[model samples]
Each structure stands twice: as structure tokens, then as C-alpha cells.
Target: MDGLNRLPGFEILPPEAPMPMPAQDLSAAPRQVRRGTSSPPLMWLRRLLVIGGALLLTGVATAEMSLVLGLSRWSATGVVLTAIFALLSIWIALAFTSAVAGLPGLLRRSDPLRLGEQSPLPQTRTALLMPVYNEDVGQWSARLSAIRASLRAAGVVDGVDIFVLSDSTDAACRQMESDAVLALRARDGARVFYRHRSRNTGRKAGNIEEWVRRFGGSYAQFLILDADSLMEGRTILALIGGMERHADVGLIQTLPLLQGGRTLLARMQQFAGQVYGPLIAQGLAWWSGAEGNYWGHNAMIRTRAFAEAAGLPRLPGRKPFGGEILSHDFVEAALMRRAGWAIHMAPLLPGSYEQGPPSLPDLAVRDRRWCQGNLQHSAVIGAAGLHPMSRLHMLVGIAAYLSAPLWLGFLVLGLAVSFQAHFLRPEYFPATHALFPTWPIVDSERAIWVFGGTFLVLLAPKILALVAVALSTRRAFGGRMRLMVSGLVEILLSSLLSPVTMLTQARQCVDVLLGRDGGWTAQRREGEEIRLRDAFRIARGHLFLGLALTALAVAINPLLAAWMAPVLVGLVAAPWLIAWTASEEAGDRFRRWGLFLVPTEEAPSGVLLTSDTPGAGDDRAALVAAAMAG
Candidate 1:
């Protein structure tokens, strides 16, 4: 018996046990040098073109509004509001234009190069690494078994190794994990291995780094998987092949689609990902080229490259914004890229799957952690030798969280300006030595046009995604009518949820700014019903904010109230909306009506089927079942 066998949950094979030989060294493997198509200047040119166009549109709109306000007086508040609007406009325009750029790629017959097939069965070993903390042992066992079965089916089981690197501290969970590993070994034999760490020093990144330092030398490549992640065997093989082919490519990230959703919130997110995720990903891939980002999991990395370049440096600051980078994936990608290794996004790749957070609360919790991590990137954005695109990725990530506060500020300023216009009297030609009295007037018609134009730009990506789906074979989402109806439902739900999310994100940003750390917490995977009282308690602030805003708007003017209606409505309905969306019953009911139906849900893939069914006569099934019972 080995030291590992002495652990409460561990079972190790005998020292004399025969194992499959590792793959040959590919360090001197001959490969053609392939440079990225989009150079930094060209990529920047494309970015600037879209941003400039947005600025032009915003400038025109702002000019029109200024003229309206200038008719009465040029208020400082007007200028400030225009600046905020410009920032928001530019942010959304970038997304809309990216979708526009991506539409053609999505419609193209051939997939992106990153997603394309490469040489089959490379003579190099790859490790499928799953880093888990306190997670459901049964689910983990089922997923691991399915992945092994998948590889076996693809005849690539011999080319890969599976590792469950546990950072779990709970004794019972560790024991359950150990038992599951033992059963899996009994059933599947030596290809799978398990190790539990007593101290999770650096958390997930630390867990992986420890593995790399210990066994990374044995593998040429490693595939990182989240606890909820699932990849088809063929997909894994393709990634390995790609790495073997592109020696300079350090990391390749696949767009993981959401599956196995059981709540209205989850289903809605699934539908969005299935329909809209591709467009956004396509656009990002198009622009990102070789400077793409890693999404933590459903990604492959060159073992040597990662080990050499991605040794994360501790930041020179206190908690929250500093210390070990919370969002390690992005920083790792940037570091790898900084070392001259290309990183790419494979959006067109299939068989990559990840489950969404089951409910609104679950999603918020995850977002909070991400918010902290992304904000931490602000410190790294200025690091030396980083590719400009890499910095942009970091900046964009930071902005994704920071935009919430900017939006809140914009709304508050707009309301303040509206109140000032309605309540305060205008000065007539006293301040300036002008003959004509400066009367403050708003060009209502022009303002309407500007508002409509902004809305159109904001909504264009969704419309484009819908059109792309419509143009394709409609069978996937149950034909054109259902697809269209589903799109509308998604839009409605997203719109209702936007205000609530905005406030939630705003709160998170404030918390981070206040030096509060979003400690690493395992996300809730399974859906649970939320009581009305619980929902109310969680969303009480939103309700109060809504009521207060509506009251103030009404007191200011009916027009103001009407303009603020959407925000007020969403905030006011937050409790019921959260409760309803969090309910699995509501999701199932909607599923019966064919609402929020995705193709994967309609016809699950073999990999998904295997993962979903853990008790199918395999020897490990009993172990998994017992673990679940425990």
C-alpha cells in the first residue's frame, strides 16, 4: 500500500501494477510555423472603425440633444449626461458591430480554423484534468465515467489520461470521492487517477499548479474541465490533435453551451446561449484571432508552455483587488500570449458543454466572484510585454463589471437633469452679454429619434442572432415559428431581468470598491425552489428602490414616470420574478408549452446521455448511487 492509499477516501493500485506507457516526447516534433492572420494593427483598425462609427452616431445624437438644451441654456448636467450616454453607446456599439462582423462567419459553410479538424491520433499524451473542490461526488463520478466511455468509444482511450485533483477539505466528501475513485478504478482500471490535497493553498489555480509541478512532465498537453464541464471524446481528440499541429498555440478555448438546465432562469440562459452565444463568440473569435482568452475550462493548454509562462505573480497590494489573481484563466492566457504562444477561441466546435447556474441567486453569486476577479485584472493590464489585444481582453473584462456602476450613474444623472428641467426656473439673458434670452428647451422629437436609434443599436445583435437562426434549418429549435416565439420570450425575460441584474452588479461593484473580498465559494449546481418570502428578502432592496424611483418620477412629472417605467417595473417585480424563475416547476411548465426549447434539450447527445445516467449497470454505478445516498 502507498501513502495515497492511507488517505480516508483514496485507493491506489499496487506499486507492481502495470500501467499504459506514456506518449513519446514531442519537444522536437517537426511543425510548420503558422502566424495569425489578424495582426495587431489590423485588429486595432477593425476595432477603431466600429468604435469611431459609434462615436459618430453618439456625437450626432448628443449634438441634437445639446441643440435642444442649448436653446434654453447649456447646463453642466446636460454635458455630463451626454458624456455618460456616449460611453454607454460606444460600449453597446462594439458588441453590436462585433455581432455584425460575426454574422457572416456564422453563416459560412466552413467552420473557423480553430474549430476545424487536424491530424488524427497525435503521438503525444494529453491529460484530462478535472480540478474539483467540495462537489457532488456522484455527479463527478458519472461525468468521469462518461468521459472515459466516450474516449473508449472513440478508440482514443489509450492516448489520454484522466485525473481528479481534489481540493476538497471536508472529510466525508473526500471519503466519498475516494470511494468513487476506487469503484471507477475497479470498473475502468488504470487510465484514471485521483489525488486529494489536504491544504488548498492557492485554490483551483494552486491545485492545478501542484499537479503540473508533480506530473506535468509526463504529459505534452492538458485539458482543463470544470466540475460541471463535459466534452465529447471526439472533441477532446480534436483539441489534442490541434495542439499537436499548432506548436505555437498554447491554449484553445471552446465555447461551452449550457445544458441540463431545470429552472426557468437556467432554461432562459440556455436558450440565450444556444441562440445568441454563437454570434457573440463568433465575433470575438474573428477579432481575437490568436490572442483569444481562456474560460477556465473546456479548454486545452500546452503543458510546457503553461508551466513556464503562467506562474502567476502575487500582486503588490492588499485583499479584494490584489493577491493571487482570482480570475486566473484570463491572466494565464495573457501570460502565455506574452511568452509568444498563440491563444485561440474555437466557437464552432461542438460537444463542449457546461451547466448554467440553476437560478438567479446562484448566477448572482457566481457573478460576484467573477466581478472581483475581473476587477483584479485592472492591476495586471499594465504589466510589461503583454500583447495589446491581451490588455484589451482584460480591460473589457473589467468594463463588463464596471459598466453596471456607470449605467446606474447615467440613470441617476438623467433623472436629476429631468427633475431640474421640470422644477427649476430658467434664467433669461442675465449671465451672458447676449441680446436674446437663453431659454432651456428639450427637442422632444429629436430626443425620441436619438432614443430610438440607441435602442436599435442595442437590440441589433439579438435581432441578427435571431435572423441567423431563422435562415438556418429551423428544425433544431422546433421550426421558425417556435424559434421566433422563443426569441421574443427570451427578450422579454432578459429585459425584465436586466434592471435587477444591473442593480445586483452595481452592488457587487460597490462591494469590491469598498475592499470586500468575494471569497472562492463553490457554485450551487442543482436547482432548488425559492420560497416567496426568501425571494422577497433577497430582492427587498430592489423593491424599495423601484418604489422610491417611481414615486420620485411621478412627483417630478408624469412624463418622467413614463420614461422610467421599464426600470421601475422590473425592480418592482424583482421578488416575484426571482421566485417564479427560480422554480423548477415553472421551468417544466414552460417546457411543456415548448417555451425556451433548445436543440440539445430536444435531442441530447450520446455524451450527455451517458453523463445524465450514472446508474446504468456499470460497476461504478453502485458506488455512485451509494455516494449519492450518503
Candidate 2:
């Protein structure tokens, strides 16, 4: 059998109309082509009025609902708020626990660079493997070339080999990939390489195995990057150094701080990530130490160790939910740890980057796969006999995925309590009932269970990340108002958006269990226009549920119902909300409204940190020169 057919968990893509793959000369894929000019202001204003109006309406509801809880001493009000509070508290505890423990441990990493270290360990050759099924190869190479430049800059060019392992059967992508490799070769030559299998077997994991089985013996270390992934040259060197420093270490994963995402949702996400990523990272590092989780990107591993632990068992079930592990990185980490090797995470080093989905629907589609992947692990954790840290990672993954469902149910239960206390259970209503109703969403009993719990665990980590970044780089972010406002807006939008995401994922899990299949699609770049239909589809269900809940909530107070109406309304219009969030026009509006922005050259160094300065020629030219001339 061809290598591709041998892998158990794979989906065959449909054939495209015949066209010659881009020739090798076409390899230098357009790294960044300016698509089209900005949408006109009149057009922009039209779109913003819609989403902004929706958000403002929702915000009013949220405020009223929260305010109601503060005034009334109704017995049931206390009960609902208290429940929400309790849930929030637990979330807080988990967040604080993780941040305090996890973040530091990641940064204080002490893995010594073996090459530069002791005598017993000889200089080991390493291969950096980037496996692409169907993606922009030139775009992919441009990123890797940056890393190669970084490695060369560190003067360790000879020690590292990069292979672009492609499973793209399409003639176009194949040629595009070939062209990129040639372009890279023109710059970096043999040190940077490319390969493609006639057929792909078991998705991503299977692709890696194909290489490991063949050239596994040649390299002492191997690194993995997602097609869209990148890391600062410094981060790569630091990772190698850390691995060498710690003899027992097998892998070091850098948290991928995503970039280049447009659309309202994407911008909101980017803002949240930039603001809150650090604290959570710090917390995770402090707790996990050498036993951190692997997120499948910007990570390094011992080639020998991975090969020894190689054979991943095909899952027991059929189709989507079962077969190969969708979330293979975690299991890989677990296997490494199980094999007596330390698996770890490094902080957001400069140039470590990933792309966010262009639109909301696209992101949901992606999450569907992730939800299934994480859910499948439910059976793997205990059965595989993983280490304690690995199990925690698995459980947390499950919890984070499942939190939406739990919160949804919790919200329903809370509103039910509000209805019961304010309208139905007159006995529990205080004398003030004649003068003032329990306001809205003021169910103390359920509020704690819902909002409180979420804030503690889910939201707290982001806050922590934000605080750390702000404290360290106060001047860059301006005063606290911007940060605080940015955080609040991000949190509010995310909360509204998440219900839609959870529902999508939940359905995906169900689909997998039912034996339907899904495939990996290339992530749409930022600034892509989102379709109205796609947006509406994603948000429709959430809006319906949100409205229902809000209406029921209003049984106690019309003002509360009126207040929450926008958020509930957004839920029902989830698909549209998602689409709009992904819209470039929406993204521009967010920017105009002072929503968010990322550095063009966010990398610490010139290339990764900032794209070529206005007049400077592309750095890739230098790499091309080095590869061809050398």
C-alpha cells in the first residue's frame, strides 16, 4: 500500500478540475498580496451600525440583569446569584491556580542546550518537519525561511534540517509547494528541504510517522510546526538550548499567539489573546514545569524518543468521533511523558505566531473538529495509563470544551429559578415585590453557578494574561482605560459569541459519534469577506435559545427582558454574527472604534517582529541569495 493508505484515520479529498500544478518557478507564492482596497466609509458605516447596535443593546441587558441582582434581597434572588457566584468562584480558583503555577514554570525553563553543553552528548542533527495536506506552500515556506534565517543567524544552520512534508495531491498546491521549496533552496539550499508522499495515510500524525520511519535515524531532534505556524529565531534557539539543558526532556511547546486575523470576531479574539495570554501561560508554566502540554505547534522533540514511542493505536470507534486521535499532540505529549521524557511549554517568545480564521463560521467549522478531538480523548486518558500531568491536561481540555454546554444548561436552570421565585413562588417574594420586582436575571441562586464560575476559571486567565502584559509594557498600551475597556469589550463579545461556538462543537461531537466525517480545510486569511448566509447559519440557534431564555427571564421584569434582549438576540443570529465577525468591513469598523490592532512586524527581530521596513527589500531575498550562492 502507498504510505497514505496505510494510515488508519484519513479522509480522501474530492478531485479538483484538471489544471497543471503551479510550476516549480511559481513556488515563491505571493506571501502578502494586497487583496483590495478598504470598503468605503458609507458602506462601512452601514455594517457597523448593525453589529454595534446589536452589541449596545446586549450590553444594556447585561448591565440591567446584573444590576437587578444587587438591589433585591428576595430569597430566590440570593439563591440564583449565589449559584452563579459559586460557579464563578470555582472557575476563579482554577484560573488563579493555573496562572500562578503554570505561567512561571514555562518561563523559568532550564533545559540546557545540549550541543553547547556537556561532553557525553555529541552534536546531534535535527530536522524541523512541517507537514501540509493542501495549503499555500509559498506562504508556508516564507515562514519557515524566516526560521532558517533565524537558525543561520544563531550560527546553527548546519545543525538543522527542515523538510516540508506535503500530502497535497492537487496539482496546483503541489506545484505551488515545489516552487516554494525551490525558492527556499535558492535562498537556503539543502539545509531547507521539501518532500511529498504520493498518497497521505493517517492525516497529520500519519504524515509525521512516514518521515520518522524513513529518515528518523538521521536526526537526533525534530521540530513540528503547523502549516500556518511560526516562531522567533530566538524562540527556536531557546527551545533547543532548553532541551539540551535538561537531559530528560523530550519536547518544548511554545504557546502560539495568533496573528493576521480580520473580522469583528477575529479582532475581538486577537485583542483578548494579546491581553490575557500571558497570565494563563505563566500559570500553566508554574504548575506543569517539564510536564506541560503540547499544542501541536512551534514545538521541538527528541527524534529518537518520538520514534521509540511511535505506533499510535487507531481509536476503537468508527468515522469522525473515533479512529485516529484528532487531538494527537496531547496524546503525543502523554506518550513522551509516559516514555519517561519531560514534555513542556515555553512562553510567547518573539515571532511565535499563528493565523486566526477569517470569519466566524470558518472558526466554528474548525472547532467542530477540535471538539470531536477533545471529546474522543475521554476514552483515552484513563485507558492509556498516562501520567498525572497528562491526565490533568486531558481533563482540562475536556472541561474547557464542555464548559459551553454546562453554562447553557446552567443559564436555563437559572432563568427557571428566576421565574419560580419572582412570579410563581410568591411566598419567597419579599414585601418589596409590590414596589420592585426581582429586576432581571437576578437569580442569585443560578448567577453564581453560571457567571461566577465562568468568570473565575474561564475569564480570569485572560485577565491575568492582560495584567502581566500591561504591567510589563505599560507605556506601549497607553493608560489603564484602554486596557480595561478593551478587556471588557472582548469579554462581553466573547461571552456572547461562545454560546454559538459551543453549540457548533457540540453538534460536531454528535456528528462524529454518528459516523459522519469531516476534513481539514486551509484557514482563510484575515480580511476575507464573510457571507451573510454563513454568519446567519452559525448564530441562528444561539439567538433562538437566547431569546427564549431572555423572554422567560422577563417574566419577573420587562426592563430586564429588554436589557438582555440584545444578547439573546445575538445568540439567535449567531450565524450572521459569526459571519460579520469574520468580515473585513467589520474588522475595519472595530479598528475605527478602537477595538484592536497587532504589530505588522510583531516579531522581536525585523522579519518576524516587523515585515521589511518600508524601503528595505524583502528578507526572503537575502535567504534566496544565501541558498543559491552558498
Candidate 3:
């Protein structure tokens, strides 16, 4: 295709067009000579201390369990169970410790750098770039108009430009996008522009690189956003101001809150993010003062620094594990840091927002792609010259997916041990010639203590988040009773969904390991009713597993059945739970009851205006209608 045909919505300009040139000398770019006060050694020390402490506690618990098992008769199955239990214990403990560390930060609410009331208007030009792939063009135009209006209101429009770069493959979607772009241009003029690529080579990262090569020199910084992302002008100004003040800072990421949820699952996700996300993000920012990781969107990057250092090289080999890196944000951050530029996170910065998947199936689809991307990091983790912290970040990403399978294995092993204890004959006489008859024994009391401890660790973070909110922002989320009740509901629902998520992730991991590639696909953001038949088809494996376990537990012992009830219940009811939570009525009912309510949902910010709202620009409904008809 010709250049004009390749990019449907924009004209192919001559060489004389005001496009920026690439840097002639990369060494002239600002580079940090020394690490920030939160030095690598100190950061590692803190992380190791927390991890080491958790491991020590896990060791003690495992040793006590071993002794209890030894009281009756030591068995191989018991040893395996103890090991898995210890591993799981350490995982929970690490999270609990992070939350404990973050509680003070969240309660204090005094990150002056992030919460500064005033910042000088940025002098540098910044491009607000949004990459879309086969998305709803009408909705995209609405969101873009809202953001443009927000910037104009803040008087920051002079220094900002908005671009909608499309990698849409569907011809109808591309044509709709072209019509929407024309409408947006007619309303907003030169400040808004759009370009559609016929062949979206290398996906989003490539789309960004093409922009950088063509127009990167004209802008000092670029704010990358996803299709569902929304940001207030003030927050954008704050991010750019931070970059301007710190010459060596290459990127600054903000914590985005989930909003615009209309399904039960989405609302629950919004609530969890609002309540629990801060503590976790605060903890991360505490340790990763400068070497923070990027989350691909709602982030600003120095144009020159990114251009010089973050040109991603394709990995060797084929699909699934190699070729193009799907998760490029993390790698880019690491590369920028390695080239002596700092990456930071401003968790306290408000106004960054994004939408969540509407239901379990939608989330699972997105998660499958993420799972493959993260697993591919195993190859990148050992790349030469990467900072130790960067390696840790990659490892954590890998572990996040791997833990699902580990948990599943742990549960399966526990079931196996139970079966052996019930059905297999015990060897009373030792092969080494012991005279005394050995009895297989377990200390029920110690086992109870271990279980209680694990449960406490698992729930402590949520409790801490509740306490933090109550102490700091109680009025924002209604009264204490409402908050507590909502939390309880969230916990109950999460417990029900945890097994389903576990099975989904475990299956995805297994599929990736078996050489299956999760192709990049656009996520469905709008809520829709899920039929029972579809739900059952999606959750068939979970049902089969749950049924088999239930039968085995019944045959073994009623106590075993009781012990496995939570997992079994979730697996068996996965289909119903998915269908029910996906319904709009279910979500509306919860909202009416003030369950899982968020402050944003209660009162939306001014930046969230719809296209129909006055001052947001001309309506694009007719444009969308015309394009759809065509």
C-alpha cells in the first residue's frame, strides 16, 4: 500500500514537515552519576530482611509440623506437605510484611514530593499518546474530548498535544476510527490528530516507536496511555513538573485507580483497588525510590532518554517464549535505568484512572496474555548489566504466575497424602529392624496453630488497609459500618473467586509451557450478560476437578471433605458465580445496597465528563452512526 493508504486518517507529509529529528549524540543526554539515597544495597537489605524474617518463621512452623508428624510415624508424604506449606507460608508472610511496612506511609499521607499543592507550569512540550487496536472509536473520541477539555480548563493546552494512533486491523473499525478522527479534528482543530496503520507491526510498542522516530524531537516528553485510561490535567502537569525538576529522571509512573465499573465483578475489583491498592503501591514506592517499574500506561517518559535507550531488540527464538517482548514497559524501565537514568513512582499522585474487565472470563482472557509475557521474562532476567533490583522485579513477575501452579500442586499433594493415610497400609516394623511398633501420628493442636497463622497472614493486609482508611479517609468511603460490611463482602466474594482464578492461571501457565502462544487481543471493557451455557463451557475443567476431589474426599473422610470445602465449593460453582457476577442487575443491586462502593463512583471528578456534556466539544454520535452505516 502507498504511504497515504497505509495510514488511513492522516496525510503523508513531505520531508519539510515539522517532524523532529533523532539525536545526533546520545551521550549529551542527562545521566545520573550516582544512585539516589535509596541505594541498591539499602533497598536490597530491606527486602532481604523482610523475606528472611518470613523464611525463618516458615522454617519454625515447618519444623513444628515435622515433629508432630514424627510423633506418629514419619512419612515421605508428610515431608512433601511440610515443604509446600512452608513455601506458601513464606509467600503470605512477605505480603503481610510489606503491608505492615506500608501502613505508616498510608496513614501519614505526607509524601510532600507527590502531594505538593502547586507546581510551576511545565516549559517543555509533551505529547499525550494513546494507542488503540480494534477499539470502540465512538467511546475513544468521547474520552479524548474529555481529556482535551480538562487540559484546556487547566490552561495547560498550550504545552500539550493529543494523538490517537490506531493499529486496527478490521476495515470497518478503521473506517469508524477515521470518521471519529475527522469529527475530533473539526471540533478541537490542530491540538488533536489521528493516524491509522494498516499493518500494526510489533503491536503497541512499535506504534510508539514509530511516533518517536517521526515526531519525538518536537516534544520533550510523552505521556503514554491505554484506550481506557483517563487523566486529569493537574495530574499530567504534576508528572511533567517532576520530570523537569529532576533532569536525570527518565520516567514517572502514577498509581491508576479502576473506575467506570458497571458489573458485579468490575465493581468488586474497583473496591479492592481503592481500598487495598494504595498500601501495596505505597510499600513498593517506599523501597523502590528511584528504580521503580513502569506499568505501560499513565506514565511519562523523557523523549530523548527513551529514544536513546529503550529501542527494544527482538529476543532470539520463536513464538510463546521468544520473538517480540509483549511486556515491554518493565524492560524499557530497566534499560533506562541501566543507561543511568532514574525511574520513579509517584503513588500519591491522583487523577490517573483506568477501567477493569467486566467479568471473570474477560479478566481471564487478558490474564492469559499477561501470563505469557511475564513468563517470557525468565529469559530476560539474566541479561548482562541489569541492576539487581531490575532482576528482582522480573523474577517477581514470573513468580506471580508461577505461584498459582505451586498452590495447586500444594493442594493436590495434600489430597494425595490424605488418600495415602486413609487407604494405604502403614508399615509398622521398620526396614532397619526396630522392635517397637510405629504409629502414624499427627499433632492436631500444632496443625491448628499453623492453619490459624497462615489465615492471619492472608487476612492481615486487608485489615490493615481498613484500619488505615478508617484512621485517615473514613468520610471518603462512607461510615465505618458500611466500609466494614463492604470489606466483608469483598472478602467473601474474593474467597469464592480465588479458586477459579487459580485454576485459570494454572491452566494458562501449563499451556504456555506446552508451547502455546497467547495472541494479543483487545479486551472487552463493557459489561454484558453471561449465559449459563457459556459459563459452563469456560469452567468445565474446574467443575470436573472439583467433582473428582469431592468424591475422593467423601470416600476418605468427612473431615477431609470439610477441610477442602472452600476450594471445592468455588470450583463447583464457578459457572454460576461467573454468570451472576457478570450481570448488570447484580452490580446495580450491590450499588443500591452501598456494597463495594468507591469514592469516585459516589462522586465523579470533573475530568470524567461524557461527550454529551457541554464544553466537552461537539457530539460525534452522527459521525459514528454514519460510519457504522457505511
Give each model's whole-structure lDDT. 0.79, 0.61, 0.77
Off by over 4 Å in 1: 1-8, 11-73, 109-114, 425-440, 615-630
Give the lDDT ranking, best first. Answer: 1, 3, 2
Q: Write the per-residue lDDT of candidate 2 for residues 162-273, one digit (tens) a residue.
A: 7788888786667556555645666534455566778667778878877777677777678898877876655666666666556677777776776666567777766666
TM-score of each: 0.90, 0.76, 0.89
Q: Model 1 compared with the native: what TM-score?
A: 0.90
Best by lDDT: 1
Superior by lDDT: candidate 2 or candidate 3:
3
lDDT of 3 by residue, 435-504 (tens): 2223346555566666777788899999999878877765666567788899989998999899999999
How many clashes would you count in candidate 2? 81
Q: How many backbone clashes does candidate 3 have?
A: 2
Q: Select the stronger candidate by TM-score from 2 and 3.
A: 3
Candidate 3 residue 210 Cα shift, in angstroms, is: 1.5
- Write out the backbone clash pairs for model 1: 9-178, 72-439, 72-440
